[model samples]
Target: MPDTLYDALIARVRSSTKARVVVEAAALTGGLIDRGLIRSVVDLDRGEVDAIFDELTRGRVLQAVGKNRWRFHHELLREVAAELSPPSVQRRLHIRIADALVAGAADGTPEWPQVAHHYEKAQRFDEAASAYQKASINARQRGALIESQNHLARALENVERLPASHARDLHEVDIRLERGFLSSTATGHASAEAAAEFERCLQLISDEPGLALYATFSGLWSYYATRGDLRRATQLVEALRLRLADMPDWYRAATDAVFGSLAVFRGEFDSARAILEAAALAVESLDSAEIEGAWFAPNDPVAGMYTFVGFTRFIQGDLAGAEESFTKMERRCQTLPFPHGPFTLCYGHTIESLIRTEAGQTDRAAQLLGDVAAIGQQAGFDEWVMIAASAGANTSSRSPVAGGARDPAALEEHIQNLTVVVEAWRAAELISFLCWYDAALAQTLLAAGRKEEARDRVDLALQMAQETDWHIYDAELLRIRAQTHDCADAVEADLRAALELARRQGALVFELRAAADAFRWGGEPHRAELLAVLDRFPAGQDWPDLARLRSLVG
Candidate 1:
């Protein structure tokens, strides 16, 4: 925790280029090791600590050699203590700056920092430049514009730094997207390739224990998300969850948020909420997510647990509440420029509609749905889905539907917000979510009296479900199946299967939705049966069906 300890770690890391170790130590000490030019974090007792302090005042570490009073031969001190004093452990601090210079620097920038003759220093500019470029590319891909810009500036600071080499092209693409230009598949491909390259760089630093894990987490997130392999993504996330078990409590929130997202995708909103409870209430960027190594609580610094708590306040019908989150998100997350996913915004909007609908403000709900449709139209695909019993859903509730026919003006306003799904998918792009889209299409067609088309859409939705390993979300598609049914027995069987599936997965949310469909398709007897099952489902949800649930409850 001493200033000397902090400086020692920085100094050693400068020579060694193994920053992960320093960061690991920082993580271990709960960040007490930062702030000062402390040479290193030592577990010295009273007498020994005092002796080191006395020596520090006289510039004992390096004053004779013109080195700063803060500088020290950390490795040498450990040797001396080992021979003549109380027991101690010391590390050959390897600075990542050294490695970055070796790997990336072409020339300039190292002179100012003044690495001693004993330090084998190369140029420092290139590594920072290269890291900036790589980070910029990743940040842009994940839509972190500010973060990308910050890194771009760092890379550019190196006078000899080449024009954004590895991810140069991507650098521009992110800029274009920020300016609202349409991004192409070629651009997406470039982004993915850039990501893979960054991953390779990270793996090269495998000697740094905790850093390697984050690089691993990054590679896996992009890979499975791109492939739509939620199953594999879920598994890897679970592994990270277990891996971070002994980590500091501060690190727990970020890891859990990622894990909770998979749970949401897997239709586990309950689990997702539980994990998100930490982040949702607190309002800030989860920097703790990247802090690596065997985690120990950082000393005395207040983290954002309080802020996350404020962020999570919402009711089922609060569209205003939902919008409030977006406001908070924009405010709290301003500095976290790119490589982060748009999961928060997209998910926030999705829940906004649900909450608005649940609050009986169907018009506002419809507007929200239209807003998302526009995002999908422009962004290529709105590639988000609520899947598991884990974590995920949107909310903040208020209702215009509390009155009989709803507030006429609000209803009109909501209707005005609807986006005509003139095309089969967003803009001209193929749908990323076939099952959900197809199922939704079938319902629209059925309502519009296009029964034949409805039946076909439903059939396709079901077929897609049968082929995918993500059989869990297959329930969304199953709603279409009942409409395809002509016989009582067929309808009954489908309803029964869906009900069973919902219960098996703890998909009470979706189950409640399906109960409404069952009432429509199952007729009097099945409606009675489904309603009874629906009784166990939580009463509130941000959807039109909340009305049905309300009616049933009454």
Candidate 2:
């Protein structure tokens, strides 16, 4: 029925070739037409176009929206009219429309996707590719990651239509690199698709050493790092370091940041702290000229370095140092460019929450998690959202547990929710902090008096730590393990090992925790050790561990 109506309208407009031409052109552009655009594309005078527009509007085939604008009353009418033109004519019309749109657009104004749309329809692959890339950048800066990804995919498709050449390959490489970065942000960095894109980019790279290095570090190395494969990440960093003599200062500083993070993963807290601090300072002072052409960079180098610095300092029992580093991180994020602001903020907030939670400030910690979630949601990054959700659940769950509450049902409910979140994280391959969550879940289980379950959870976490070379959380797991056992000998042995491991890692926070647990539950055998650890902290810190230690021995 709709087709019959469209056919009748087409027959009526067919009386004049000019009217038919006008109808076909408008249909080709999806029935959207303005007098200026129609007059530009078609060789019709203003009065003649106005008469055609009046006839179409009177026939109910076109709707007059405003001055010089008209759209098909029904989309099907446009589709039917479009079928009247041959492919050759359709291609000519598309080229004319694209040229007109380009001619009218201002410089630096975002490329209208309509221009790309017409170019693609006209089989003009080169122009289409360029237009799509610009649109992708515009979408990305606006935080529309999915839209950006779509534009990039179209750009890549258009580039593939061009004949093979070194320049084409280079352009393809650029598109893939951009797409891979977007994928890592839209999906998780640990996603297999993101890894594959980077790998493909590396294979295509011939004369672009900087791009190759960028792909290696940002895409490949980051995939492993986010997946908790610290061993592979360390290997990549070491390989990059081997060529340090040929690299720029920014590359060198980025290498330091990556190494610092890997060091923290391996429980080398002191080394990690020094590396990250130096890297943060170097990155802050470097000029734009010194770092030009360096593609191997974090979203925000200064904030990225300080994020690791804060975490390392916190683990090493330097609360003041952690606080100072986090302050710097927050300050830098305020003025970061698009795509950097939310991500750096999320990283900074996550670490700050960890520090806040450790200092017995549950409310503050929860608030930070909320902020991280908001940032992630606003930025359209699901990884941080899931991270915030999982971490938030653990935080709220543990807050009550720390108050000496022993409601098994409530604790079980929390465990179930966390278990669901863990499954989601696993599905998304967001396992960077999987061990941390396991340790937190074990803590909750212990609070509910489920010693057997807690022990099982802690064992799984320890096994994961060993498998991934992620020992940063081992000391805390061992301390938790001490509580799961009923035998006095087993308890003392675990506590002693926890304390030793904490000290070996230079994790004063964990060391004090282990020592405090020893004094409280190990029959005061570790009283002197606890006192020694306590003496290392400043006099007036509000750390929960320090508060617990004072309450116990005073």
lDDT of each: 0.42, 0.79
lDDT of 2 by residue, 324-377 (tens): 888888987886655666777887898788778777777888999999899888
User: TM-scores across all candidates?
Assistant: 0.50, 0.83
Clash total of candidate 2: 0
- Judged by lDDT against the true structure, how good is candidate 1? 0.42
Lowest lDDT sum, 10 consecutive residues, model 2, at 289-298
Q: In TM-score terms, which candidate is top?
A: 2
lDDT of 1 by residue, 1-554 (tens): 45665455445435432332333323222212221222233333445434444444353332222332222334444332223211221122223323333333346433212121102122344444454555556555665455555655555455233354534433332222222211212133113443444454344443343434543453444345334566666776666666665555554565565555555545454455566665554414434444322111110011222122212223212223445555654443333322122323343444454444444555665665555555434434434321100011111112322333334353443222221231323343322243444554455444444567667766755554454333435565565566666787877677677766765655564565567667766556656656666566443434445555647535
List the candidate 2 regions with Cα displacement exceeding 4 Å: 1-30, 34-100, 206-208, 242-248, 287-301, 407-410, 422-429, 521-525, 538-540
For model 2 the TM-score comes to: 0.83
- Model 2 pairs whose backbones collide: none
